[model samples]
Target chain A: DTAVSQTPKYLVTQMGNDKSIKCEQNLGHDTMYWYKQDSKKFLKIMFSYNNKELIINETVPNRFSPKSPDKAHLNLHINSLELGDSAVYFCASSQEASGRTDTQYFGPGTRLTVL
Target chain B: AQSVAQPEDQVNVAEGNPLTVKCTYSVSGNPYLFWYVQYPNRGLQFLLKYITGDNLVKGSYGFEAEFNKSQTSFHLKKPSALVSDSALYFCAAKTGANNLFFGTGTRLTVIP
Candidate 1:
């Protein structure tokens, strides 16, 4: 059983196009997160949702929006994708939202290529 | 503010030799540190964490880390490295808000 999973493993789109990546976790976790890994392999958190409520919103651009329909799912939608958006997106989940000690599990990741 | 640093960009080791990947952290309050490993084309995998227990923490795949409060470091170590252990390693610090700050990853190459 995959604890965390992300759909559309690879996304290739033209500049200014819009795309969405889906994430789901069966770990029964209360918190979900989205992270971006740049070409240099620098990982940074973008957004987090706890029980379908926005909790952590980093200094990300407004073009990127995260939506959580339910506690088990979190999706990221990128509008006007630019070349800078070409990177890997990871989805993660934790057992609780308030526990700083809780371990997070990550999904396979979606590789986005904005041409 | 919370931050993690991995000084080494890459470390090469031979099979059967011990390996160490250094990590340091800076945070406001008590530091909650974590180690994650990533293979090519894969997501980050949890290796270990230091909350408030023993300074020496053991983790998956024969890995361990020592947490030093004075030094503000959590360095991952392995007694004997295997070629399969070659991968990218990351150190992270969790903040009071449950946000994680990751360091620039260190690539470990375990040569056969």
Candidate 2:
């Protein structure tokens, strides 16, 4: 079974459109995170949720929002997508909190294209 | 604040040869350093991590990383290169906070 899985492996949409990416993990990890990999291949943390509580919110645009209904799922919703939003988004989860020793498991990633 | 740096943008190696991907970091307090690999069109796969106790840590696919506290460096190395090993490698650090910082990433190309 896949540890972490995201739906819609590929997404293509036009500007001003809204989209949502779904993620789920079976590893029983407490913290789930969303990362954006831009065209330059730089992965930056967007949001992190631990047990449905918002932990970290980086300097991301308001168009992006994350919702975790439960510990096993974290979904990303992007509103009014822009051309610059074309990139790959990944979902990851880790076991613990407050430290760096926790190893994160990542999903297959969803490639988003704003045309 | 925690940060990671990947000095090389790309590393090319021939199959059966050894390869190294350099990574360094800056963080407050002890660091939990990690190496991850990403194949094209895929997300990242955790390779190995250093959480103290020892200087070297080994992970899947025969990849290993050495963590140096004085130099604040964690480099990924492998004894033999394979075409399948060609992928993007990322180095990251976890500070005292829950957030993890990632380097830009180094692209590895293993020629057969």
Candidate 3:
């Protein structure tokens, strides 16, 4: 069984376009996170949700919003996508109590290209 | 703020040669270090971690990392390199709030 999964492996769109990347996990985890890896290969945490509750929101812009409808899903939506927003986004999940701690299982990333 | 550093952007090694990728971190209180590997067009895979006890931690694919508290360094090392090992490696640290900060990845190219 796949622990974590994300939709739309590759996305290419023009500027000013709005898009959404969906993520899901079947590991029965409580904590889910989103990370962005830029072209320079610098990966940074963007958001983390614990049991459908927002826990950490980094210095991400207001244009980017993360929605967690439930414990097993975390979706990222970006408005007015700019060239600078082009990067690979990853979704990960971890168990909170005994199933998860400091260790997170990642999903196959979704690459977004803003032209 | 907690941070992790990978000094080398890329490292090259022969197939049979030993390889080392250096990483350092800064965090308050005890630190939890982790290493992950990412191949082309793939998500990162967790390799190993250091939470408590045993400075030397072994991970998948015959990979191991040594944690040096004095230097705040956690260097990944392998006795021998394989051509299939070519990938980008990231070093991450959990310093505070149980948050993970990843280093600028190090690309390892094992030449045949």
Candidate 4:
């Protein structure tokens, strides 16, 4: 079974359009995270949620918002997408809030392209 | 603040030869270091981690990492590399606040 999964493997939209990417995990983990990989292959954390509670919010723009309906799901919504938003977004989950010793499993990743 | 660094942008090795990918880190307190590998068009995959125990930790696909406190380094190593092992490797360190900081990444090319 796929431990972590993401929907809309590829999203291509025009500028000013809105889009959303869905993420889910069946590893029975408590914490989920959203990460963005830019053109340079730099991976940065965008948001983190623990038990449906927002925990970490990086200095990302307000145009990007993450919502967690439950512990197993965390979705990212982009408002008025721009060309800069084109990149691969990854979903990950870990077993503990400490995250120090836990292994975070990642999904296949969703490639977002804003033209 | 916590951060991880991968000095080498790329490392090339021949099949059946040993390989090493260097990684260094800095944090306020004890660090929880991890190694992840990514293939083309795929997400990152967990390889191994070091919390607190033996300095050497082993993980999937014959990959292992050594954690050195004094040097503040966690380097990934393989005794014999396979052509299939060619991929991008990432090193990360976790802070007290549970934030994970990732290095830029090192591309490993195992030539046949």
Candidate 5:
């Protein structure tokens, strides 16, 4: 069984277009996170949700929004996608929201190409 | 503020040889360190982590890491590297806020 899964493995859209990536985890983790990996392979956390509550919000632009309908699902929606948005987005989940020892499992990532 | 650093951007090793990827961290209290690997066009996979207890922690796929508090480092090591072991390795440190800070990542290449 896939512990964490992401839909729309690839997304290509023009500037000003909007797109959304869906994520679901069967690990029964309460905390979910969205991360962006740039072309330089630099990974950075964008947002984190715990029990459907927003916990960590980085310095990301307002164009990107993350929504968690339930504890097992977290989705990312980007508005007015730009060329800079061309990168891989990863979704992860941890068993506990504040448990420092919990390991976070990641999904297969979504490659977004903004042309 | 918490941060992790991977000194080597790339490391090449021969197949069947032992390999090590260096990682250092800067955090306030006891550090919560983790190692993750990423294959081409794939998401990050948890390799191992060091929260407490033993200084040496073992993980998946014959991987292990040593946590040295004095040096503030947690380096990943493998006894015998395979060609499939080539991937991008990342070191991350978790903060008190329950957020993780990842390094720039180190690309490992195992030559046959």
Candidate 6:
């Protein structure tokens, strides 16, 4: 079974358009994260939600907003996307426990292209 | 802040030869290091991790990593490279936080 999944594997849209990428996880994890990989293959964390609470917010622009409706879903909505926003976005989830660490299971990622 | 670095952009090896992918990290507290592999057109898959104890850690697909605290490095290694092992490998680290910082990935190409 797929542990973590993202919708719309590929998205091509014009500049200044708005788009949303959906992510869901069935691993019963409490922490979900979003990462953006640029053309240089530098993957950086954009945001993280633990149990539906915003935890880690990187230096991402306010144009990118992440909304977690519940523990199982975390959706990213970009407003006024720019040409520089073209990259692959990945969703990952992990369960956190005291004094124990877990590996993050990633989704198939959504490749976004802003023309 | 915590960060991970993968110096080599790409590492090439023969199918029968051994392989190594170097990774280094910087963190204030103890580090939680992990290695992940991403095949073409696929998501990143977990390979192994070093949370505590056992300086040398073994993972899936006959891969292993040595966590050198003195050098602050966690390098991935494989006994024998396979053509199917060609992929992008990433090193990540976390320090007392739920967020993981990933390094610029290193591409591994095993020549047959």
**Model 6 C-alpha lDDT per residue in residues B1-112, reported as the tens digit of each score:** 5679899999999999999999999888888999999998788999999999999999999999999999999999999999999999999988775568889999999999
Candidate 2 residues B1-112, lDDT tens each?
5689999999999999999999999888888888999998888999999997889899999999998888989999999999999999999988676588899999999999
User: How big is the positional error of residue A43 in model 6, measured in Å on the Cα after superposition?
Assistant: 0.4
Place model 2 in a CAPRI quality band. high
lDDT value, residue B24 of candidate 1: 94
lDDT of 1 at B102: 97
Using TM-score as the yardstick, the better of models 1 and 3 is 1
Give fnat for candidate 3. 0.60
lDDT of 2 by residue, A41-106 (tens): 999999888863686565899999998888899999999999999999999998866546788899
Relative to the unseen true structure, what is the C-alpha lDDT of residue B87 in candidate 6, on a scale of 0 to 100?
Answer: 99
lDDT per residue as tens, model 3, A2-68: 7899999999999999999999999888888899999998998898887636765658998998888
lDDT, residue A40, model 4: 80
Q: Lowest-lDDT window of 10 residues in candidate 3 chain A?
A: A93-102
Query: A49-111, model 1: which lDDT tens digit per residue?
Result: 886468656579899998888889999999999999999999999988688799999999999
The candidate with the higher TM-score, 2 or 6, is 2
Q: What is candidate 1's CA lDDT for residue A13?
A: 98
User: What lDDT would candidate 4 get against the real structure?
Assistant: 0.91
Clashing pairs in 1: none
Lowest lDDT sum, 10 consecutive residues, model 3 chain B, at B92-101
lDDT of 1 at A86: 98
Q: What is model 2's DockQ versus the real complex? A: 0.82
Q: Is candidate 3 or candidate 6 better by lDDT?
A: 6
Off by over 4 Å in 5: none
| CAPRI-style quality class for the chain A–B interface of candidate 4 | medium
Per-prediction TM-score to the true structure, in the order listed: 0.97, 0.96, 0.95, 0.97, 0.96, 0.95
Candidate 3 lDDT, B1-112, residue by residue in tens: 7789999999999999999999999888888899999999999999999887999999999999999999999999999999999999999987545657799999999999
Model 1 C-alpha RMSD vs. true structure (Å) is: 1.0
iRMS, candidate 6, in Å: value is 2.3
Could you tell me the C-alpha RMSD of candidate 4 in Å?
1.2
